[model samples]
Target: MTEPKTRRTRNGARLPADQTTPRYLGENIEKDLREVSERTGGGTMQSRILVAAIALFAERGYENLNMRTLAGWVGLKAPTLYNYYASKEQLLVEAIELGMTDFFSYILDGIEDVPREDRLFEIVRRHAGYKMRHRLIARANDRLIDPQFARMFLPEDTARHFSGRMADYRHTVEELVRDYVADDALVSPKVATIALLSQCDRMAYWYDPGGSMTPEQALEQVTILIRRMLGIAA
Candidate 1:
């Protein structure tokens, strides 16, 4: 019999929605996928550690956030923290996967649901809003797994897995572009997708929900930008 395929929270081409217990929360899911080795001092320890990791990673960037520092932040000995993450690379990979999983499962799902012409605008707005809402996680994702910097953090296996997901995710964007172009809705599908991703990816760096605009307000502005780029009358 064929081996049962593991029910992954992430995958290439299409990621499955998280059906697991919502209690297990974090951007880095690989750490949580393994059997728990670190005993929780309290029920909230896991959640706290995850948040701490995100904050620290955002502050220091992946290159500087070593295991020892990470462990110290969580009040665990470096060796003892191995109970939670076998290695820093594995942990980084899992975190990257979590962000992408959310990206595809929810954000891309929204793109797929709407009609082709409106899809790109919806994608840009939602993508910007998501990065704003999950700022720290989004910043880490942008820096850590970028192709030029990927080798410093991800193991070979992790890189392969991540590359697969990224290609699949881009293909989804490409499909939308193609549909819009076929209908004369977009001037240049490839350029449009590239521009959209570039614009949306930067939202993490500057998003401030408490600043001059709320996320909804920002999303509306981004929607207008996308529509203008597509030459759609507002």
Candidate 2:
């Protein structure tokens, strides 16, 4: 092997195009990636802290959630979390936003392009199963969304961000109900939809994954009830 070719930059530094990267440049890229990850909290330990924070917030609610508890869950010193999130409120905002994103994404993704007639069953099933399976998300979402809860206590910007997510969730569900009524699958569109959603959403309040009734069984009963109430077939 004589010598690999190289291209020179304006400063006369050589780069082996598509062949090899300079050691200094490689180090710089790695450094930048780490910096960005730190700022964005996408690093492994940082994300773990967020996960723990969400779980704690869900299990204990905001007032009970503290930096020490969050740090304990992430297996880090309390002061170490500052390296990722600026404060507990910032952590709460990020975790709730992520949780809402997951909740809506899972529900909407399941119902999209699905006919209103079929959507009834899917919604009930998804709602029950999600609440049962993702208890932390269920608890956290419920607490954050209580009309007088987070909105009244959290920072204005953080609270407003959560309010937007809550609004979008309501709108999407409303649209689904409207579609159902337009298709003649449901009567008393708004009233019936609200009633039915309240029924499904409240399951999280009492849902026990370890209980005798599995999520599927509970969903089946709720679906049957809603179908009967709406005059939907099966």
Candidate 3:
């Protein structure tokens, strides 16, 4: 197979896209981060900068990450950085969208031929797993209350574009949950589903890979939590 292209974190350092560091915790995190950055642009310089920014924002509040400091982290002149991202807010919005897309893709990719009840559980696990794994990305997505993200990253037209694709996966799970509730396979499937999504959607704010939890361990815990939420007695 052809070698994959090299990618960089925000610091302009060269790192292989396939490589995953302990700092990032899992291969999927790096993969997802890079994929999202590539959606905006290519190369290690751009991707690494975006990854660094997310990691920083996760550590420090958004206000702490001004353009000068962010540019310094990426080893670029702050003004030149604007060529890539118009402003810090715009950059944040794009990153959030990329993060969401990365996560939704993972959850959608895992759905298979299992029964509807089991399918709902699987969806919960994968969605939770992704969030617990890529907490920074998830957190950045959650921090999208800024008007820029609402107006720019997720305009009605953009939301519709995302929905057109995301709808299939979302609808599949919703219907599965609805059916499970009807069949008594689950209690409060709708509530369970929403809660599960919330759990996955806010990983970035609280998940610290340096802390006591590993991504796999977090996934396991989240899976059990979601099962209990669904009254599945896991």
**Which structure among the candidates has the greatest TM-score?**
2
| Candidate 1 lDDT, 88-179, residue by residue in tens | 66676655665566556557664556887777667776778767766655665566567766776667777888888887777777777675
**Runs in model 3 lying further than 4 Å from the true structure:** 1-43, 55-65, 87-89, 110-117, 145-172, 183-188, 200-218
Give the alpha carbon lDDT tens digit for every residue of 15-101 in model 3: 433322312322244555565566545646766677656654544445555566567655677899888888776676555555556
Candidate 3 has which clashing residue pairs, if any? Answer: 7-44, 8-44, 8-48, 9-48, 9-49, 10-48, 10-49, 135-204, 139-204
The residue pairs that clash in candidate 1, if any, are 28-95
In model 1, which runs have C-alpha deviations exceeding 4 angstroms? 1-58, 61-63, 75-77, 109-118, 182-187
Q: Residue 99 error for model 3, in Å?
A: 1.3
| lDDT (Cα atoms) of all candidates against the true structure | 0.60, 0.62, 0.60
Query: Which candidate has the top score in lDDT?
Result: 2
> Model 3 compared with the native: what TM-score?
0.59
Q: Write the per-residue lDDT of candidate 2 for residues 65-119, one digit (tens) a residue.
A: 5576567545677788898899777787776666666567667785768887667
Clashes of 1: 1
